[model samples]
Each structure stands twice: as structure tokens, then as C-alpha cells.
Target: MGWLAAGDQYEVALIEGRVAARATSGRAAGRQLKSLPKALRDHPEVDRLRRFAEWLDRHAAACVAQTDLWMVSSLPVPTGLLARVWPDEAWQSALRDLAVVGDDPDEVGFLRDATEAGELRVVNLDGETVRLSPATVTLPHPVLLPDLDDLREFAAELGVVQKVEQIHRATWRKPADLADNATTVTEFSGGTYDSRFALAARATSLGYRVTGGYATCRVRDTGAIVEASVWIGEPYWDDEVTTGGLSWQDLDGRTLPLREVGPVAWSEGMRMAAALHAGRRVEEGKDT
Candidate 1:
């Protein structure tokens, strides 16, 4: 942004997301000040810049959140949409270095850039930059990535840090030995919290919805929508509560047999249950 006249002696502007001032006259003429001059502290220009910085922070956070939602849902994003938003720094930051799959599901690459013409440039596992013009791409959930470990290793080698968690996201796989009629997993049950409110608060803070007495996460698995829920406590319960068994339900609210749950849904449900369980109040000095 161009420097604006703040006062006769000072000019101020945003520099690297911060308000900075430079002397317009005197001994320090044209030199950037180490700190904003006292006179410009309350200047209109300074206040405007500060407000703009605050807005930028909010925009960046919203971009990250939207990107996270896309990844978590493994939704297919149009190439045109990516091209349109690539010029925005906030959007770019949230998308850069994320693992993306093009039309060919087998081909995985780290997103580097999206062109105005709807082409994507990405770094492949082999460390070569390749251009792809697929109509749509998927920022797949880590649980669905076949080469997750290799991608993680390659990302480390290249110093890639994704603003939206992707390759390094925690994932779980369904065990092959589940009983035929089992409908719930009790592995994360019995986690104690000080109060029902505290348990519900933890679920909300972790991005899960508290519906009825369950902390729930809804996911689209394969072609079906499934909701994984872990019982926390009834809405009016004020006393201490323990997490209940985790289970999956179909769109019609029918309890799904463990064997029928898709891989992605199973993993995401387990992830949610485990996160809530992890927050259970622990005794002081006890190993977490």
C-alpha cells in the first residue's frame, strides 16, 4: 500500500500487515521509523490501517476454515474455482502445499499454483513440477490417501507446511475382525469429565456438533452420508458425565452395523470420539 500523509512530518502505510511510519522531513527524512511515531499513534491513517489489518486476519482465518472443511469432506473442487481464488493471498495460503488428486485418482501431488486459465501446477512425489488441467480436483482426507506416509516424508524433505492440515492428519482404519452384528465401538467410552457442560464444551471446541446427548460428526462416505456420534450426556444433565460408545448412523437415522460403515466415515468417527476422550479430566501429575 502507498504511504499516506499522516501529518506534516510523518507518512504512514501498511507494511507486511503492520502499520509503519516514515519521517517525511527533518533528520530522519524518508527513513522508516523503528516504531510508529507518537503523533501518528492516533492518526486517522494509522487507525484505518489497523482496521484493515484486523480484517485481513479475519479473512485469513475464514479462508483456512473453509479449506479445512473442503479437506475434511474430501469434496471435489472445480479447477475454475481454484483459479479464481488463487490470486487472493488468504485463499492461496490456506491451499498451498495441500495434497490434491486430479482426474486420475492414482496421481497425487502437492499443490503449488493455479493458473488463470484453470490449470494447476503441482510437485509430484518424484519432485518434478507438473501441470494438470483436470476439470475438478479433490483435496482428499488423509484417511483416503493411499500414499500418506510417502507424502509425509516427501513434504518433510521439501519443507512443505500446509495451512490446512492434510497429509499429516491423524487417521484410523477399521479392523477386519469386527463381530458381525456389532453396531458400536466402546474403545473411547467411559472417559470422565467434570460436568456435562465441560464435555459438551470440549466437543464444540474440537469442531464437533453437540446434538441431543451426543457429540456428532457427519461425513459423506462413498456415496452415502453417515453421522458418527458419541454420547456425552443429556442436555439438562449438570452432574459429571462419561463418554458413551461411539456409533454410526445412516441418513435415515438408522444405526449402521460396524461392517457397513465406510472407511472414511469410520475413521472420522473414531477420530472425533478419540479427540473427546483425550480431553477427559485427568488427575494432577498423572501421565497423560
Candidate 2:
């Protein structure tokens, strides 16, 4: 952003997401000040820069959240859409170094760049840079990535840190030996919370929706949408409560059998349950 005239002797601009001031006609002319000068702290230009910085922060967070949603759903994002947003630093930060699959699912690579002409440059597992111009690409969830461990290792070697969690996201696979009629898992049950509000707060903080008496997460699994939910407590209850079993439900609200639960749904449900249980209060010096 261009520096704005803050006062006769000072100019202000945003530097590294912060308001910075510089002298215009003194010994420190043309040099950025270590801190915003006292006179410019409340200056109109300085205030504007600070507000701009706040907006940038919110924009960056929103970009990361959107990117995470795409990856979790394993949605096919159009190449043109990526190219259009590639110029934006906030979008770029969220997308850079993410694992991407083009037309051929076997050919997985770490996204490096998106060209204006809808082409993408990526570094594959074989350590080769390749360009792909497929109409669409999928940022598959980690659970669906066949070479997830290899990708994690390669990312570490490349010093890649994704702003949106992808390669390192925790995943679970449904077991094939589950009983046909079983509908819920009790592994995360018995988590005690001091109050219903505290439990609901934890659910929301972990990005899960607390509705009615359950903490819920929806996932697209095997062409069908499923909701994985764990019973928290009544929304209006003020007394202490304990978490209940985790289960999956179909669109019609029928509880799905454990054996019928898809991998993504099972994993996401368990993830939410585990996160909520982890926040439960533990007795001092007792096994958690």
C-alpha cells in the first residue's frame, strides 16, 4: 500500500500487517520507524492502515477456512477458479504446498504455482516439477490419499508448511468386522464437563456445530452426505453433563449401522468426539 500523508513531517503506511510511520523531512527521512510515532498513533491515516490490517487478517483466515473445507470434502476445484485466485496472497498462502490430484488420481503432487492460463506447476513424489492443465483438480482428504505417509515425508523434506491442514490431518478407517446392527461407538463417551455451556463452547471452538443436544459434523462420503454426531447435552441445561456415544445418521435422520458408515464419516465423527472428550476435566495426577 502507498504511504499516506499523516502529518507535515510524517507519513504512514501498513508494513507487514502493521501500521508504520516514517519521517518525511528529518534525519530519519525515508527510514521506517521502529514503532508508530506518538503523534501518528491516533492520526487518521494510521487508523485507516490499522483497520486495513485487521481486514487483511480476517480475509486471510477466511481463505484458509474455505480451502480447508474444499480439501475435507475432496471437491473438484476448477483450474480456472484456482488461476483467478492465485494472484491473491491470502488465497495463495492457503493453497500453497497442498497435495493435489489432477485427471489421473495416481499422479499426486504438491501444488507450487497456478499460471494465468489455467495451468498448474507441481512437484511430484518423484521430486520432479510438472505442469498440469486439467479442467479440474481434487485436493483429496488425507484419508483418501494412498501415499499419505510418503507425502508427509516429502513435505517435511521440502520444508512445506500448509496454512490449511491437509497432508497431516488426522484420519481413521472404518473397520470391516463391525456388527451389522451396531449404530454407535462408545469409545469417546463418559467425558464429563462442568456445564453444558462449557461443553458447547468446546464443540464450537473445534469447528463442530452444537445443535439441540449433539455436536455434529457433516461429511460427503461415497457419493452420499452423512452427519456424524455425538451427544453433548440439552442446550438449556445448566447442570453438569457427560458426552454420549458417537453415531452417524442419514439424510432422513435414521441412525446408520456401524458397518454402513463410510470411511470419511466415521473418521470425522470420531475426530469430533475425540476432540470434545480431550477437553474434559481430569482429576489431578490421575490417568486421563
**Residue 111 lDDT in candidate 2:** 95
Residue 256, candidate 2: alpha-carbon lDDT = 94
Residues 86-190 of candidate 2: C-alpha lDDT, one tens digit per residue: 999999999999999999999999999999999999999989999999999999988899978988998999888989888888888888889878999999899
Q: What TM-score would every model get versus the actual structure?
A: 0.90, 0.95
lDDT of each: 0.93, 0.91
lDDT of 1: 0.93
Q: Model 2: runs farther than 4 Å from truth?
A: none
Candidate 1 lDDT tens digits, 1-288: 798999799999899999999998889999999998788889888999999999999999999988987888889999999999999999999999999999899899999999999999999999999999988999999989986898899999999999988888889999999999999999998889989999999999988999999999988888788999999999989899999999999989999999999998999999999999999988889833
Worst 10 residues of 2 by lDDT: 40-49
